[model samples]
Target: MEGKPEDDGGDLTRRGFLGGTGAALVVAGVPTLGGVGVEEEGVSTQLLEAVPQTAIRVTVNGTEHRVEVEDRWTLNEFLRDHIGLTGSKIGCNRGECGACTVLLDGEPVYSCSTLAVWADGREIVTVEGLERGGDVSPLQQAFMDHNAAQCGFCTPGQLMTATALLDRIPQPTTGEVREAMVGNLCRCSNYNAIVEAVLAAAATSGSGGAQ
Candidate 1:
């Protein structure tokens, strides 16, 4: 008669949620490795290998810095946690929300989805980068004037995306603005004001103070 596998006195037990493996998969990062046994219900998070770390040199706003970043650390994490730039919000912590938007090499990117190591030797512009000489960019001013921010949770991401759009289309129409800003979501449902602010800013300046 075949016998069941017994535990080796480890904190991880052999009988882990095996009854609900399918349902538990709904949780992110809870993968069942091929041999590690998260699949067969084994291996605790504490027993996982050490997170890989790497040193990268990247430019933020305008200043350059060489920093040690973990391979798994997202751009949003590097910016907010490591460098102390919290202007970028982590609304969904996924690429869908666009609340963690930042300009990476002059193009808008979802920071939460972008790995920090991938930004090596690249230019990054956060919402905090919009100011020049201690003054807000025209786009930022337009947002204020149009009351584009309600809760302000999504404003930073919105501003970054709009900056990239205006850079590509200096004089974008209302429709263009809407189409360009489709990725950035505002929970307050203030689309009209946000669009208007982008248009107004475009009329005033080609770039949104991004370098």
Candidate 2:
């Protein structure tokens, strides 16, 4: 009979879920090859390879942050992992999909392609920054009212791009709206709702929309 595969004794065991301590042990880090294995001393060895870090000062959501970020880390990683801003989703990672979009200096850009180090001394804004106090911005409310966010993966990108457009042209025609949001792709195929939401937010710009 073939022997069952041995448990490598990884950090997360089945019982960890019940106690809740197992999940805490799974720290985010660079995992080395064969890092988890029983050593000669009968101890499981797991090590994280530390990477070079760079000091950067960035203004995110109107708040300034000075942090040491890994040189190899992308803007998306810095925002989601370091700053605890998980609103930017990592999709297509190559800039083809704009799910990882964020505003850099008031312009929409794919955070996945932008390096964290490159954001030094620059202003950045993610979807989480859309709310003022406890209320969502009118642009965000418009998206909800029009049912623009189907799966919501591409909503943030669409919102940022549309926001930039509105800032330039307070009132945009449907064609202009279409052109401005061309880069943001909605996998849910809800383009019409997204366009309508932008238009609605534009119409209500004086109310409480993103200003």
Candidate 3:
């Protein structure tokens, strides 16, 4: 029988030999003909090539914020972590719950679902921005007056939605308020009071009846 392939001093098989050689080449910092490094860590290091962090400028509630964030960061992260504005609650982070609602360019958007990069150079409005000169907005007053909130988890989102509705329909009918706030779920089952609150706010603000 052909002499058993000369046993290497070590248990190194042909595949193992090639693997170790590749790893050594990689660690040696050798560049391959393919213009890539031979080592795994070398490849990873090359791929990571420290890029300068991107700087994002966003206007939140009329205040400008210059923040450095990764491309993957979400608007919710920017709002809660970067700016210290945490009034917008994070319920189901997947955008199913309206708890993280905020206004972007005058439209209600789910901050959790929106990427921070996408919000760059845009105006954002959060619950904390609703007050004027430290006075609560009429919608907020209406919520309290009508006992529209309980447990208070969904109130921020409710207020934001109500603000948007009133901006569009100053005097929303009871049915219109219900339809507009459909996305916001109140675990407290305070829909009746919430509707009343919105209608009251519309009348107070002189928005006229809902279309």
Candidate 4:
């Protein structure tokens, strides 16, 4: 050696020291934290990057949509947040309250209990879709006429359930209406009028605005 390398601090040069540490970190699969290039505890960068998203093509309110949505997103989240259909209310969020009800292929389902990916290639009918040409559908009119909506929180679910019932049975008896709408709970205790409204709508419209 001519004179040997000058020691900046010790036998380990700063550049060589830092380079070796960085290589060690890379081999250990350590992820960067902040600007210091240090790994954070309990934070797995690989898991963060692996969150899943899926592409879905669904027909909502008679319109078809092709969109990408997170896999964890619920149907209620997708409808209210992504598509802006706020009529479906999230009350219990555990399938207890039918407030988040919507028609899935002519059947009533709780949007909160349903998944967005499950609705792919399916048809959805929300309360907003009950209107035609700026006028509320006959079933909606019947609800107003019968004073079925007290707080109006459970009306959407009630409407959707009634719509499905009418789709199958154009004329359902009072017992049948009650049995069909049993899943939808109304906290306002307006059961009498709600049943009446469904029967009235069925009497007037053959299909209860299902068409």
Best by TM-score: 4
Off by over 4 Å in 2: 1-50, 206-208
lDDT of 3: 0.79
Q: List per-candidate RMSD values in Å.
A: 13.1, 9.1, 17.7, 18.2
lDDT of 2 by residue, 70-169 (tens): 8988999899767768788887999987888888998889999989999999999888888989899888999999999999999888888887788778
Better of 1 and 4 by lDDT: 4
- Which candidate number has the best lDDT? 4
1 or 3: which has the higher TM-score? 1
**What TM-score fits each model?**
0.77, 0.77, 0.73, 0.78
Model 1, 64-108: lDDT tens digits are 989988899999989986787878999999799899999999999
- Rank the candidate models, highest lDDT first: 4, 1, 2, 3
Q: Supply the global lDDT for candidate 4.
A: 0.86
Q: Please give the lDDT score for candidate 2.
A: 0.81
Q: After superposition, which runs of candidate 1 have C-alpha atoms over 4 Å from their true positions?
A: 1-48
Q: For model 3, how does the per-residue alpha-carbon lDDT over 1-211 read when each residue is reduced to its tens digit?
A: 2122446636556644654565677566433323542346535445423323478899998889888776776899778765667788888889887888988987888888999988989999999888888778888998999999899998998888888888887777788888988888888888899899888888887542111
Clash pairs detected, candidate 4: none
